[model samples]
Every structure is written in structure tokens, then in C-alpha cells.
Target: MGSRRHTWVRRLGAAWLAAAAVVGTAASSAAASAPTPTKSTAGPTPAELKRVDAHAEKQRERLRLPGMALAVVKDDEVVHRRTWGKDGDGKPITRQTPFLVGSLSKPITSTAVMRLAEAGSLRLDAPVRRYLPWFRPSGPSADRITLRNLLNQTSGLSERDGIAHADRFDNAPGGVERTARGLAGARTGAPPGERHEYSNANYMLLGAVVEKVTGQPFGDYLRKSVLRPFGMDGTLVDERDAERRELAPGHRYFFGHPKRFDPPYDASGVPYGYVGADIDDLSRFAVAHLGHGDAAARAVVSPAGLRELHKGTVPAGTSHRYGLGWRDDSFEGERVVWHGGATPGYHGTVVLAPERGLAVVVQDNAYSPQRDELLNATALGAMRILLGGRPAAASTDPMLDAMLTTVTVTAAVLALALLWSLFRIFRPSRGRPRGRRRIVVGAAVSVTGLLVLAVTAVYVLPRQVTVDLSEILLFVPDTGWLLVAIGVLATALAVTRGGLAVRACLAAPPLARTDPDAVRDRRQEARAGV
Candidate 1:
């Protein structure tokens, strides 16, 4: 009997193993037979591309963005380029539309500096005092400050003096001089070239240095040497006096209103030279940089100079670094040189992966309010396409990821608890009597609370701000306080509503009764219901 049992057990084990192997083979076969998604040559697949398009549209809608244009370049060719959103009059934005590239102006400035350097008209190591004898930073350090130092943003100067947020451009007499002198007189935050500090003042001073060296305004010098040479005829230098008929007005989000800024002059009397022109010209500029200084019938800088611009100068924290006006980030073992542009109302990003020969340009009218995760992902996605690799779904958004995880966990817990509460509340009872009055009161209270929160948030709070799109763009400063006050009101509404629901439940009939006779009635109803 023992021998027979052992033989039977062996046979059963063999049969189980054979069955498991067969199941495994079948599963593997099914997986292999499953249709794998093919990468689209035109762009991302319909669903993926739709998500990106929809996301851009939503941002435009929420931020009241007037227009947005994007161009993706692969292997030095513009593979896919599209424009979405609208102009001031609701006209569709096109490839030729010009949006202020904002701080993107720095790289262009840097290019001009390179040309000057190559011509021996300026030296990177030479101090600014060589040209602008009147230009001075604090004392000894000012004399030591070099063109390279300014480009690298290690000039030991705050980018700007304490300019009030409401006061955008300096309106004082000789505002540019006063602003420059104020920055020059400001105390140093670190020893010269000790560490990297992004100072707009550095670039501003560099602009002045260009003017001083070239015997013309910075704008004229940039036009003659950079823009004119490259045939980037659409690029504008003096945006202060831009033709209103041809210009795309910049817009900002105020409460719920999308407010545009009036033209004819920027806050600085210097013609908004620090940030100018739109996306297409910017990409042309990037193409020149990524293509080693020659692209689109323009040779803005020499190949060697372009290399210098991309050469890492100092460690940008731990993972990346800065080079001239460019940034160096390691993406999937490939070196990516990129830059971002931002002003009060608009945000722009230019990403280039030279090794992979990919470039992406993004310009958004809305300030992300968080570190720009979407912009980074877009760039990374473009880079992955250049590498012929699929972009993994892992999120690089720090704040968004945290918020999403918190929301998901909170939602799960709430859902489980809600289901549990409903299950218990609706459970069949043996003989308890129904309480229609309690249910009616609960429903009415809940409805009333929701209506009140909605009314306060949508109608009352927004009314306080007076979201007039027309007047604010005329450079009116009073709108700032209105927006702030309204945001506070909105926050108050959210907090009040969140707490009101729980508070309303406090008036709900008690599950336990104080009177002993009530318990008997409850028991009778429970029995009957059961």
C-alpha cells in the first residue's frame, strides 16, 4: 500500500508540473501574439498626441493664453511643427506669429558677445571698465568682473535691485542708468566666480558692455551683428516701440481674467531688449546654436564659439551645469543643452540634445506656479523620439506627483469609508420604523451647503476682483491688489465648504437614542426590515 501511494504521489506531481508548464507556454504565446503599439512617424500616436494637444488647449483656456506655437526639430530638420490657440482678435496663431521670447534674449546676447570676442573687439577675460569707464560694480570686484563672468552669472551682483512687483519697468529719469548703478552698488552675495548665481543684472550689464564696446546701443549692435547677418529679419530688437498692428500682445492670468499688456513701451525705457521676439525666430536661433553656428542662411557664430557656449563652466547643483548662456543636463546618458525664458506673464523653454540632434521649443503665457514639469517632460519626450526610443510613463513632476499621490490615497480611503458607511446605514434591520423626516432634513441641508459654497466662490469672490480684461493691460497697477484679495476669498470659500459638509452632518439624527422607549421602536423596525 505504501509503494502504491508513493507511485501515485509522483505521478500527481509530474502531472501538475506538466500542467503548469502548459499554462506558462499559453500565457507567453498570448503575450507574444498581442498587438504592440507602433510608434507614429508623424508625431505621437492619436491618443498620446491628443493628450498633449488637449493639455496645451486646457492651459490656454485656463490661463487665457492668446496664442501658443510649437516646433519640434529632429536631426537638424523641423520634423513636426504646429500652432494652436489664437491671436488678440481670435485669429488662429500661425507659424509666423511672433511672441516675446523673454529671457531667451540672453542666448542671442551671448552669441553677439561671442562674435565680438572672435573679432578681438572684446575679450571674455577683459573687465567692462575697458569700454564703459563709468560702469562700476562695488569696488575691487567691479574691476575684476569679466565678460565671461557676466555670461556665466557669477558677477557677484543681484540681477535686479529691489524693484517692486507692481512697478515693472523703471520710469524714473535715466531709469536704465539708475537701475544699473543700483545693481552695481548692491553688495555681493558671494566672492566673484565662487558659485553660480543667475543674475539678470549680469546680462543687463553685458548688454550695456556691448553698447559701450560697439559705440552703439545694445539693440543696434545685436541687430547688425546677429540678426542682420543671419537673415532673421522677423526678429525685433527694440520692442518698446513695436508696431501694435503687427505685434502679438502678451497676456497674464488675473483671478479669472486673461489680461494683456499694452504695447508701445516696456517697463524699462531700454525697449524690452532683455526679452523680445516670438517662437519661430527663437527656434531658428536654436537651430543655429545646435547645428554648430550655421543654419537657415545664418552664421551667427563660429563652430568653436558654439562649442564654447555649450562647454560646462560650473556644476549646476549636483546633476548639471551652465555654459555661457546655455544649460547642460544629462538626459539618458546624452548631453542636453537648454534654456528657459520667463517674465511676469509669459514662460518659454528651448531644449536641445546635440548628441541626439533633437530640439524642442515651448512658449506658454501662463506662469506654471510650480517648477515647470510639463515643459521638462515635453522636452524629454522629444529627446526620446530623437533617440528612437519610447518615452516611459514615469513622471518627473515633483509637486504634481506629490499632489497626485496624496489625492489618490485620500480618494481611496474616502471611497472605502463612504462605501462602508453606506453599507452600514442601508443595512436591513429586523423591525425598525422608517424615519422619512430625518432623511429629508439631511438631503436639504447638504444641498443648501453646496449651493452656498458655489455662490460665494463663483459669483461673490470674482466680483471683488473686477476682472476687466481691457483696462489692466494698459499698465494699470491697481489690479494687483484686487487679484490678491480675490485669491484670499477663493481660499476661504474652499476651506469653508470642506468643513461645512461635516458640520451639516452634526445635525443628523443620532444612531443611538437617549430614551429607552426609542430603543424598543428601533428594535421593532430592525426586525421588520430584516
Candidate 2:
């Protein structure tokens, strides 16, 4: 009886083992057929996205921005997006509204160059002349400038020189080539790779090089290789593209208020600062950079190549390093990769926290030199909010307010002074001195001083500010026109004062002939009488 029980137990055990194997096989097959989950699938919760939206809105209101668009991405998914106010066209800003992204185009251009490099079509360390033989900037070391130098902005191009050539508003074809050729006369301030200096000219030349190598228009190449592949269909590469899409206008700060500014399209600037795109387009770009298994990004650039683009190659500042086109810096002790862009009427910022898998893009319709820091901070604040930190309260820029106030007060004073001078010129005062020699000397001195002041205002001041007069007018019409008004008023005042002096001298009665003989006779007659 015991032997029989043992046999039965063995048979049941074998059957049980077989059944277990069959069930495991079925389970494995089901698991293999199920869809794979992605990190983006578990992105930031809705509540978190709502917080980011609220913070962004608050910042827009606090900054008094006329229009703004913001997007937040977690991993490869856009978790939140919002738009406020109106665009340059007075239409409510939407996901499709395009803003001139300014220097943000640098990164996009850099990616294109990198793509070519990866394909072995170009070498980063090769001199620019290898592609464009006519390329020669005015510097002894110009021959040493390599494609990498331009990519990292260490080609020794000066910001002042860049400003000199920027914002030409040239809408004609071949504008990029013309501008690049124009750089032959430009002098570099330092040796190639010696230091990093941000210059739009660097990218403009790169655009030219791309055209030469690819035998295609820069815009066409960019569209085929970068924009289209990345699904940025709304991005406008040049003036024609912008017009075709009816690109919205941007705003500039005038007396601390945002005003619509319909800037002329600059086709030459497309490679560096003129590329336009809406928020949705930029969100895709941000996702690609995050590298969270984005198929489109992978197809455009290899993972290693993307990493190289973000690597800090040179020191940009004490706290910042510049990669190919991105700035690597720390924000509140966290690694942040970012770039800030500003044209005349728009300001935008893209901030990425790679370690945290977070990206934020903030764009404001209005831009001002004084408000640049504040505008950029909005993106940083959004990042902080996403990281579970309360955003810092928006702070008013007292300095900007003071500057606008000073500009207004100075303008009024200049007008008053000019009117008073004109009044004095037309209606001479009885108490005015009647000495012709003194009047002539004073007028000559006053005219010379006024001429010097006018020249300095027109020339020296723009250099000191590191922008041309036209840029000042484009970005800050009030200040730009004020500079012009100052020159005009100073000259007018000088001319009127000099004219008054000349007229006074000519109108003065000929000095009474103090005849020495007459004086002597009078003295002799007095002596005789005595």
C-alpha cells in the first residue's frame, strides 16, 4: 500500500510541474505583446502642470508683458502650455503664433552643422576657407578660424562688430551671402579659439558655409534637414516663409508699456536671429534635446552628437560655459542648459534641466535691454515651480523705471532749453552784454562745444551701448529718437546762438573813434582854463 501511494504522488507532482510551465509560457507571450511604457507616459501630474501654468501667468502679469507663450516638458512629453494677451497683430496669441526667436536660431543652426559633420560632409576643425575659399575676415589669425571656432563662438568676432552688421532689414535674396562677404572687412578682436565672444556674424558665416557645401540655399537645407525632419512645420526660415505664414508681429517697450512693432523682415538674419516659430514648434525642439527616446530627434542627430552639442567646451563667464550653441550654467545650484534670445520686439528663453528631465520655454512679445534679465527669469521661475519649489516673487526693475523717467525728463528739458534759446535768438534781451569781441569769442566757444556734444551723442554713445543707432531705434524708439533729438537740438541751439552773436557784432555801432588828437586837445584846453 505504501509503494502504491508513492507512485501516485510522483505522477501528480510531474503533472503539476507541466501545468506550471504551460502557464508561465502563456504569461511570457502576453507580456511580450503588450505595449512598452515610456517615461513620458508617467510625466508630471496634472496638478503639477496646473501649478506651472499659474506661476507663468503670474509672471506675465507682473512683468506687464503684452503677450506671452509658455510650455513645460517632462521627459519627452509637453506637460503644460499656456498663452496670454495678444500678438503683434492684435489677435489672441495661440499655439500657432510665431515670434522672431532671435539668437535662439543659433542652436538650430548648430544642430544642422553638427548633422553635416556627423555625415562626414564637413569637419569641425577644418578652417572655414576649406568650404568658402573667399572667406577672409580682417585679422592676422583669420586663417586659423575653424568651423568649431564659429560653432563655439570663439572665432574672435567682437560683439560690437556683430552689432554693426546686425539688423540690416535686408529682405532681398542672397542677403546671407552678401552679409558674409561683407565680413571680409571686419576685424577680429582676438585670435581664433582664444576666447568666447557671442557674435551673430559667426552664425551668418556658418550659414554661408552651409550653403556653399550643400549647394543649396541655407533656408532650403535647414528646412529639409532640420525643421521638416523635426516636425517644426510652423517655423519660418526667412522673409518669404514669414510672409507665407502671416507671422505675427512682436512688441517693444516704449515708456514701460508694450507697443506693437512690425519690424521689417531680415532674410540675412535668418541663420542667426530671424528664424520664427510658435510655442508648439519650440516644444518639439525641447523634447528632442531632452533625449528621452524621441524617434525624430534620434533620426536627426545621434545621441553622442547631441551630448557633444551640450558639452561645455569653453568658459563663457565665471558661472557659465558655452557649448556649441547652448549656455551651460547653474541655476540655484542645479545644472541648467539655456539660451536667451531677444530681437527688437521679442524676448524668449529656453531652459533645460537634463538631470531632472525638465524643460521650460518662455516667450514674451515685448523686450527691453533693461528688462532682459527679468524676462529670462520667468523661464527659470517656471523650472523651479516644476521642481517642487515656490517661485520667487516678481521684483520690479527700479533701474529701468529710473532710466525711462530720466529719459523723459531729459527730453522735456532739452525741448525747453531749445525753445528758450530760440526765444532769445529771435527776441534779444536788453540786459545782454553789448561787447562785440566778447560776444564773438563766447559764440565760437559755445558752437564748438555744441558740435562736439552732438557728435558724441550720435557716435560715441552708440558704441558705448554696444549697439548701432538703428538698433536703438528699433528696440527703443523713444531712446533712439531722443538721441537724434539731442543732436538736432544741440546743433540748432549752437547755430542760433552763433547767429545771434554774429548779428550782435554786426549790429553794434562802430566803436566811437577815440581820436588820440581829440583827447589831447580836450586835456590841453582843460589845462589852459585851469
The number of the candidate with the highest lDDT is 2
Q: What tens-digit string does per-residue lDDT give for candidate 1 at 150-241?
A: 88877776422322111245443444444454455555666678777665667666766777678776666777788756656677655443
Candidate 2 weakest lDDT stretch, 10 residues: 28-37
Q: What is the TM-score of each candidate against the true structure?
A: 0.61, 0.85
Evaluate model 2: give its TM-score: 0.85
TM-score of 1: 0.61
The 10-residue segment of model 1 with minimum total lDDT is: 28-37
Model 2: per-residue Cα lDDT over 410-487, one tens digit each: 456657877887898778777744666667778887787666656655665565556556766776577667667767
Query: How displaced is residue 122 in candidate 1, in Å?
Result: 0.8
Full-model lDDT for every candidate: 0.53, 0.74
- Candidate 2: residue 291 Cα off by (Å): 1.2
